[model samples]
Target: MKVLVMKPQELHKLELLLPQDKIAKVIKKLGRQISEDYEDKDPILIGVLKGCVVFMADLVRSISVPIEMEFISASSYANGRTPEEKVDMSGGPEISIKGRHVLIVEGVVDSGRTVQTIIGQLRQKEPASIEIVTLLDKSKCRLVDIDIKYRGFDVGDDFVIGYGLDEAQKYRNLPFIGKVANE
Candidate 1:
């Protein structure tokens, strides 16, 4: 899909990576799969915030099972394209994760540092189980090994924006995902 953003020069610099319809289909499929898998488990859907907000919102609606939702803010992209070795995490879930099945939703997995840190921290809470679901996976850029149970797309090493992913905190509101030009 081609988007002709006549006004915004930044938008014009983007090339479509994944269209909205494809993303929606992936989300719906994932939601159904999660609902089926955790039908009786009553898992908690923990969204990695800022980026996961849009994906989480749509994902929960597609799910047909009774579930709880929470948010955690973690980041390693404060300075550059490549993630910092360390991650900063804040605003964890209010509810206890002890003995509960936890499903973490992330918008993108690049270096795996931030999510790895989050998993390590969540492990201290003694949750019954922990799984990760990500919208975009860039395995080529992974610095550390991590398992993503559910993945929407496995993209090459490109700076992607839109559909809750961003660069410098912009383009996240776009319904479709795009690869940033000259990145």
Candidate 2:
């Protein structure tokens, strides 16, 4: 089968979904809220890798309270838009999560499979508390229930890219979030 590759410039045709300023505002609000909620707990900000890097970086900076940060890599989109039943995870938290307040940060939540799986695994580690914060929430596509403590935007079910989210590992460097054309 021939692989179809999208040129970087072709992304210009995508519709702008979330601008940088808007994303920043959301992150700032989330950061402040997290800081206030965890003022005494000293939470560990765990980023879901590959996609959460950009959002996590900005969010951590916006947060005023001191906190620890770590990354866990996982993916369920090996084939297409719909996530696979299984999640492939690696490089989980290095420190002990037992009794620690863990916060999972994600770029977007669509099917909720990947994040849900991660949360279940983290629960096994016996953290004091676990919560989720996502930059974008696509509730229309959710196949499972997830409690998102903080959400930046509620978007329709569309293939989005930018600000850390990607398409075939491309378009992640875009400064703003946008929906793929015809998807």
Candidate 3:
């Protein structure tokens, strides 16, 4: 099967949604905010594996303070595409977040279900602070209504991919964010 992204007369272009320069500016701005917030403290950034890898990498590099980075692999995808399934989290295979300032970096926030589950699991460690940071903030379909401390972008009701967001495990290498065109 093939995918049709755009039609000449569709009047909507993927390139218009998220510009490359804006994306860079937003990421750098967030990094500055984080640096100021933890100027005198050592912050531990926890990157949710797979999706958030690219965003986490960029954010960590931009941060101007000494910080530790860790990885946490967890999944909440259940059968099909229905969003009512309970997400299952995997205990981080390496490193411990106990008594650390944990900033969970994610690709995007849609329903907030998967991250919510992960946060619950990590709560047992009693970290000094647990905050959520996502590259894309979709408030239109947020089910849990969680406050994303560091949001790179606030988008509308559109399916977005690229810049670490993927359709089916692809398009993570695209420099700018794009949305699927609807017929």
Instruction: Give each model's whole-structure lDDT.
Output: 0.88, 0.88, 0.76
Alpha-carbon lDDT of model 2: 0.88
- In model 2, state the lDDT of residue 23: 92
Q: What is the per-residue lDDT of model 1 for residues 1-183, given as tens digits with 9 covering 90 to 100?
A: 555443346445678999999999999999998989899997999999889999999999999999999999999888466788879899887999999999999999999999999999999999999999998999999999899899999998998889888777777899999886672
In model 2, which regions exceed 4 Å deviation? Answer: 1-12
Q: Of the pair 2 and 3, which is ahead by lDDT?
A: 2
Question: How many clashes in each candidate?
Answer: 0, 0, 0
Poorest 10 consecutive residues of model 3 by lDDT?
1-10
Return the lDDT, model 1, position 178: 86
Clashing pairs in 3: none
Candidate 1 error regions (>4 Å): 1-12
Question: For residues 1-183, what per-residue lDDT tens digits would candidate 2 score against the true structure?
Answer: 212335765523577878899999989999999999999898999999899999999999988888999999988888366677788899899999999999999999988999999999999999999999999999998899989998999997988889998877887888889887673
How much is the lDDT of residue 140 in candidate 3? 85
Better of 2 and 3 by TM-score: 2
TM-score of 1: 0.93
